[model samples]
Target chain A: MKKLVLRLRDLPPSAWIFFAWLVTLSVLPFLIILAMSFAVRSESGLISWTFTLANYERAFHLVYLKVLAKTIFLSLGATITCLLVGFPVAYYLARATPEKRQMGLMLLFIPFWTNFILRIYGIVSIFGNHGLLNQTIMRLGLTDSPIEILYTRFGIYLGLVYNYLPFLVVPIFSALEKFDLSLREAAMDLGANRWQTFTRVLLPNVREGIAIGSLFVFIPMMGEYVIPDILGGAKEVFLGRVMVEQFFTMQDWPFGSALASVLSMGLMIAVWVRMRFEQRKAGPTSHGLR
Target chain B: MGDQRILKVLLNGMLAIILIGGAGFWFARKSNDSAQPVLRICAWSNYLPQNVLTQFQKQTGIRVELSFVSSNEELFAKLKAGATGFDLIQPSDYMSRQMIRLGMLRELDHGQLKNLGNLMEDVRSPAWDPGLKYTVPFSWGTTGLVINTAKVPLSPGEIPGWGMLFESPDPKRTSLLDDMREVFSAMLIWKGSTPNERNHQKLEETLAGLRNIRENILMFTSEPRQYLARSELNISHAYSMDALQAAEMKPEFKYFIPREGAVRWADNFAIPTSAKHVAEAYRFLDFILDAKVASELALKGHFSTQNQPAWDLLPEAEKNNPVLYPDQATKARLYYLEDLGDLLVLMNRMWAELKI
Candidate 1:
């Protein structure tokens, strides 16, 4: 038994176990969904596994394709907005005195410890037509009418920024913490101006952080149903709402699965491209750091 | 090496606790929970008031745990999974018949229900389950056009028909129900056929008529309250209860039963054969059947009273309201939605094709 244990320990602790677990849980669910996309749905709402590309063909119609494109566009817009808002805040937090920084970091995390649904309700209470913001604006005589804000794309953007800001902040904060401060100081000392030092030294160092943050935001923003459903009303149509309509209201499971698989594929391609870019940036550093 | 070993041990301990604690607590809760008797109710999120459950608990000392299912398909899927986790379920009349045929329903002991006689004559002997053998009627409402009278023309004593919608002066300004059964039935009635038509040619004709009115429809929606509150569109075909609820919120909003007649449906509470809290479930049903409780529900919401005594007991303010209790002639022009069986599936497919 000792000999067997020694042999097992000597094998470099194979990562095959983790790979198997991932395949069983994550990859299998995706494959099942992909398989379901090609199945046929009967009038009785029964799904039959008679291989067909009809669902995909049906999905290619102009209305759905336009909605898919719009979803991608919304996700891209949200990801960029998060990075722009989060970068300075993260940098400020990372560079603060250690004592104060802990408190700021804790403040950022305190809201997350509460239920996600409750946090969303908090946003609604603030921005609803009869809510505080509208009441305040109307009281101040900014305009005669309450602004049509909550159910528009503006509302969707506000919701997206509120929910996903922390994801962007956390990773950038970690990257900033591990950042080599000497590189920036040395550049500034050697006649590089503040902007020059920041652009040349700080930006390149945080590429990984931006990629990680964008991936976190972009992937989820694609499948985000609740935020849009609550905030967008019927004015804007996202891919998530379309898929839900197919499954629940329309009773077309195969078509819904097809839409889900298409969304998954889009997200996978995005993550893959981001990883490749990261690898290119990290080419020499992993070995040099070691 | 010693420091590395210590760090490794600490990480492993944390990981072990996270995984095992989560799984163990879940498993322990599942098992420990199995021993306690729960009257599992599968229904909409807020179909029944919370007071009903608490009162039943007070009287019977049994806890009722509710599991919400959002749609008909979801309810069926849970039942099909052989999850006996539910003791009582609320399904519409069409689905109640299907569940009964599938042997998922338990034959109720009518002797347990003293208020069974209080149910209206029409709801008691439904065509779906004749003589109310396996189901207990709860709430019912008709599907009709709810018009904003401030916007739509209202001639003296001239009732609007389905033609106001299908042949609307402005097609782009109308709205319709998103439900297949209700929409298709409305279309059928518009085309001068019986609402329960099995004829394929008649179904196609109905679909074509729906297509004509499609452009006029601003949008199809289930939450009519949201749209009505905004006064987004002037006309909407909706459940009478939903319309009444919205009208109460916005007084200018008015609900009318169309001249071609509309579909009415009843939602029922039934005991599943696999129930563990049959006694408590019955007790809960009986509590809601009480005149005061039923009246309170009807007065507060858009609910039409099935209890005649409760309807009479309500104050004059409520009793005079036509939305809650329509006149005899308006009631005569409405048809209760019967189980169309295979014809429903056919109608659903037809509606899908038209939308495409």
Candidate 2:
């Protein structure tokens, strides 16, 4: 036993620390949730230990399917908007002088200093009927009545895109900064047009950065309730809202777990596909030396 | 090299101890708060007046701490998830019933509550708690309508019933509650059905009615006070406290219980089974039960007091406000929401469908 202790002490502390985190933070909790998804909810709305497939059965209803489809559509719309807006911002930021880059980066991160919910609430006041925007519009005589922007799907899209634009920008910016300037010249020297150079060479190189950044925003977006709840005026039922209602309003823990498990499984499959794509891109050369 | 490594390890060990000791000292300062008992109560936001809490602390020499919840379901979620630190919790009528049925509440010791006689006789035995066994009624309110008369083009006397909600000149300027039970109760009352509706056929009709109004409603929000203040919402389905307080502040916005009637909910104080400071909890309860404190609470919160003595202490102008203390005819229209038992699943399912 003493030798075992001494051997354990001899091993690197970081390795054991990471192992501890893996078990406590990720693996154990996931296993528990997976087990709970199959559990039964008593008539009292509390969980019982008995196993049942009723939660999954209920989760597969048309209502949940509609919610899932809406959530995916909203998230996809936000991600696409982020990409369109982020590319130009990232290019300017990456190509700027040191001081300008620093200032630009500072501007990008300033919104993050405040609480996420507080920032969303700030959006509410700006777009609300009695808000600054509407007041300005009326003064300018843009229209007779206030344009109804608040509590609409358009407002939710603006919020999701606004919050996540920086996340997508930073990564693509880093990739652009590392890009070789002469590559464009080389492509031009080989008679490639500007559009071809951008599409063929630049985009392919930055696609990884884009994928990683999109996933960073997309995963969290799938679980977002506050932005839609506040900015969307608690209308347009999303998956996260349904999941929360299951636990709090409905008091159905088993059903909530079942919904969560399905979402997590979908996310894991996405991550697995990403990893496989990267592995195929890397090919077998890296392992040949071993 | 070995000697150097040992010296480094010793230095790090001392640093770790100092860091941990600092954290311990910081926490110990909070735990070492004198010999005075600490009473913790979790209640709805703005329910417990600061002055009352201060007076109780001064009289009993017990320190008080407070946490707040926005809804009864939130309170239930917290306690049911193994939150045991609170000595007392405030639950609404239906939630109190649900908790009592589940044996999650501690029975009241009538001997400790000396000021119990201050409560109205009618509230002495509610349907949820027979013989005042588990809960003490705090305040009663009605889910009613608040209309901005300046924009709505209607006099306070001319305000129609629930029909005005759907049939308003600009229904787009209105909002309904995000709460399933409240919205459903409003619809049930409008359709001349019981609030805690169980018949699936009637509920189906109610669901269809909600879907029709779903387009008319600008949004679904439990808290519409901010919107009403900004005149963003001309007509809103609001709680009595929010509407009454807004009416008092802005006379242009009139609040009234619709003739179609509405859901009447009461907040109550009940000790959880996991209470640690039971004696201190009783002392705090008796303090609030005092007629003087109860009247102050009602006056400040804009909710109707359950204490009869408190009602007597109120000003004549307030005592006669039909909105606050409704006339017998209006009172006859109010319905109390109860635990719907197994039918809650159906209620939630229908609510989800309506949202979709």
Candidate 3:
């Protein structure tokens, strides 16, 4: 035990410091939120600490359950959309000549320089009733009336894809950069077709990236408010909007907090399952390395 | 090894202190007074004239802070996050009642408000807060249609009514406010059920009428001023203030309270129960109620004044604007929103259903 203490004492200062701070700052909030999940709200819209399972039970009601299910479904659709659209672009950027790769990556990042709300607002200017898109279509004699594209489910879907595609692209691009060309070449050299090489060699190699990107888009999409709020008009009602109405219009904090806690638990379970899967996959290779 | 270990231990201890101390200080500083008491006033972005705030700061020692929220929902979130330390808040009539029911508002002493008498007699002792118990009436406006005479010219003496919004051949040619209550109330009025009616059949009829309007609406927006100014819309079911704002920007724009009547709303100022500087909040409220300040607010925000004396202070050109002061008959037809209680849940759900 003395030797163990001495050895630990011999370790670098920065590493110890980083670990301590990470635990206190990053980990503490989640614990607080978890603890808060058990609490209840008073008539004053303020939360009170009383250990009760009522909030969780209330969260399971049909209205909220349906909302949660819809949120998950929407997130799944967004994730799949990002993957289908992002993977090829990521691949193209990764395999491009060195000079072109920088430009492609810059194009992905340029949108980030603007305020997010402004970008969403910019969509209105382009798609509003007398907006340029409709004006152009009219000038070209495509139709007599302006196309109704501003306040529909399709508009919301388009906005989500436009906003989150970068998140998916950046990660997969990073993964593809470190991808070993020889693995794909070896598969091809051994009579494997392009599709076989991609599935067997490329997919496994970039699994971490895909997982990271999915988590990035999926988690936020579940709690997404602004995109749907602006583009969806009244057509697409999501969980976030429902939560806002509950808290503000209905003045039901207990119910809103309950809904929030359930959503948090759902997200935590999703992350834990993903991490467990990744850990299981890593175990055999880590043992081989040892 | 022993000497190296001691050195490393010393370094580790120092590191731990730095990490823990930094976080502790960060949180401490966050809680600590930044020497500026942030007074978060949740109102429309263009509602409060900055000049008035600056004048208030000069008169008093307190630094005024402001946050603009497009909807009451956003404002509600800030109020719920108690750590935000907002001293004052502005909410609409029904929202004020909801907040008061939830005990979010501080019980105001009318004695502190010197300009309380400056408010119109009718606006005082409102049903929501009888005898000015919790909130001070800030700015009032009626929800109605703003017509662009250039696109859909009114006949020689014709004014645009609510029916004009639905009667156009192209259903996707008009605009409406995105607010559920306003949109729903307008539909209720059009259906001939009183906006305050609690009957189930009335609600269903209103809901059905709204569904049709929803189909007809090109897009619903909170900021109708933008749509009107750009001519993005021919006619919009808009707040009187927003219509006045559009008229100021473009003279061709004309605003009218529809023949079916419209919902009148008053955005009010109140100190929250958690206000640290209640005196300053009261002073601020009273300052806005002053005749000069009221007129200045009218000029800036383009909302009508409830302070009757402020109307005389304005120039004849400004006073003559019908949107600023609709005639007696128009005023009689309008209704202000009152608390709906549990029925709000049904209304909200119906709105969601319509959107879907």
Candidate 4:
């Protein structure tokens, strides 16, 4: 027993503890869920020990595939929109004086201080029927009536972009701030047009920040639950809600576990591939600000 | 060097033992918390008022711990997941039947409930739990349409049915209950069947109807009060508890049971097999069964009480409210959503397909 204790002590004690914690709390639970994904759902809504590939097979059905496609489509659409909407704001922030930049950032972060649901309520007030948007449109005589927005696909897309806009902006702003502005000036001095300078020098300089920011938004929007349910009026089904529905409403833990694992597996692969691409982009000498 | 190594080993061994012993002691204390009998209850939110809890504690000296689940399905899933230490749980009619079948509920000692005689005749020997063997009815309600009259034009004398809600002028302004049973019950009854629909032919027909209606409805949600408050929804499928609350808040909102009828359910109090404080749970049950207490709770909590004496104590205006206390003819038309057991699996599949 003393020898065994001595052998155990030979390993760094803190390292052993951390390893144990990670395995118990993270790895073990994930493995259990993976196992459950392979199991069957019983009639009583409990996990049946029978092994089956039926859950995975059912996931591949056309109906479920449509859900998957919609999930990806919405997330990608939101990400792209965020980049377009956020880049200009980030540039302005980066170019602003230090005092103004601080205030701009403060305003951007104010919404975050409030609860997420409350911010969603604020969004609803602005977009609902007879909401501020409609009231203004009516006052201005823009149209005959209120425009339907919240219960449409466009609404979910806008919600995703709206919630993640700040995260996307901060990273791009940082990159632009750290960017040596002389690069832009040098390109223009060499007979480059404004668009040429922007596309060639400025954009390339901030590629790392832009990529990181896009990822920050993309990953969360992929699994977003509340924003769509609240602002989008839950007119559509998404992966996160589907998983929750299976677990809580349907009481089908095995199927919910299967759905979750599929999502997690896809996310892991996507993130891994992105990391690999970034590594190659950054090989040898690091490009862009340190 | 060898002696120093032995000393180091001894020091480490002693430390490990002390840590293990301390952890064990902490767990021991957690399990046996206090001298005061503690009863843990898992019920729907707002069903157990703070004042009721305080009053029960004051009268019986039993400490109460409360938790909430949004739906009966969620409550079932929690118990199935081996969540223990719940002395009492509030499950609706169908859910109580399911729990009884699964042997998850403990048989109630009616003798301990001195106020059992005070319960309404309708619930005393409910179809779900005959003779009140495994459950005691707490609050009962019906599922129906709650309309915002300012948006949807209708006279108080001219009653609207499910057909009107389905064929609503503005489909985008209508909301259905997100619950499978609630949604399917309304759909089934509207399609000329009972709420506890069983015929596969009819079930398939209902499924198709649900799919068609899914696209036209604004959204499906268990909670539609927020939308009604914002005037975002014209028609919503609602429980009496929520509809009444919404009506009270906004005079424009009115609860209406369709002419084709709707589902009725009773949320009941039942002890789980995991209960540790059985005696305390019984005490709390009897306190809730008390006529005056039940009456006060029914009024304050916005739920229709199943205790006749307690309900009798309510003001005539409240008693006469059509939505709360419908006429005997309307009561006869109401159907209970039953525990379909294996058929629930099929219902879940149908819901999944419809949502997709």
Per-model DockQ against the true two-chain complex: 0.10, 0.48, 0.28, 0.31
Candidate 3: clashing pairs of residues: A234-B355
Which candidate do you rate higher for DockQ, 2 or 4? 2
On DockQ, the leading prediction is 2
Tens-place lDDT digits, model 1, residues A1-290 = 99966654444323434555688999998898899899987645557889999888867766567777888888789888998899998999999999889998898889999898788768767877666788899999997766766656778888888899998899999998989898888888888899887777788787678778878888888888778756654345678876776677555688889989988887788778867876776666642221
lDDT of 4: 0.84
TM-score of each: 0.71, 0.92, 0.80, 0.86
Off by over 4 Å in 2: A1-12, A15-19, A284-290, B1-34
* Candidate 1: pairs in clash: B171-B216, B172-B216
After superposition, candidate 4 runs with Cα above 4 Å error: A1-26, A140-144, A276-290, B1-37, B170-172, B198-208, B211-216, B320-322, B325-329, B340-356
Q: Provide the overall lDDT of each model, using Cα atoms, as 2-decimal numbers.
A: 0.76, 0.85, 0.77, 0.84
Q: Which residue runs does candidate 1 get wrong by more than 4 Å?
A: A1-28, A46-53, A185-200, A246-251, A273-282, A285-290, B1-39, B45-70, B97-103, B106-121, B124-134, B142-263, B277-302, B306-320, B328-356
Q: How would you encode candidate 4's per-residue C-alpha lDDT over A1-290 as one tens digit per residue?
A: 99977876665645566767899998999899899999998765678899998788767767667787888888998999999999999999999999999999999998899988888778778887778998899889998878977777887887888789999999999999999998788888988999988888888788889988998998878778887787766767787777788887777788778888888888889889988987777755464322
Q: What digit string (tens of lDDT, one per residue) describes model 1 on residues B99-120? A: 8877788998889989888887
List of chain A TM-scores, every candidate: 0.88, 0.91, 0.85, 0.87
Which sections of candidate 3 miss by over 4 Å? A1-74, A126-148, A248-250, A271-290, B1-44, B53-80, B83-89, B95-115, B159-161, B164-169, B271-286, B315-323, B327-329
lDDT tens digits, residues B152-201, model 2? 87753674688777665767789888888888888888898879778999
What is the model-wide C-alpha lDDT for candidate 2? 0.85
3 against 4, candidate with superior DockQ = 4
Instruction: Go through the candidates in order and give the clash count of each.
Output: 2, 0, 1, 0
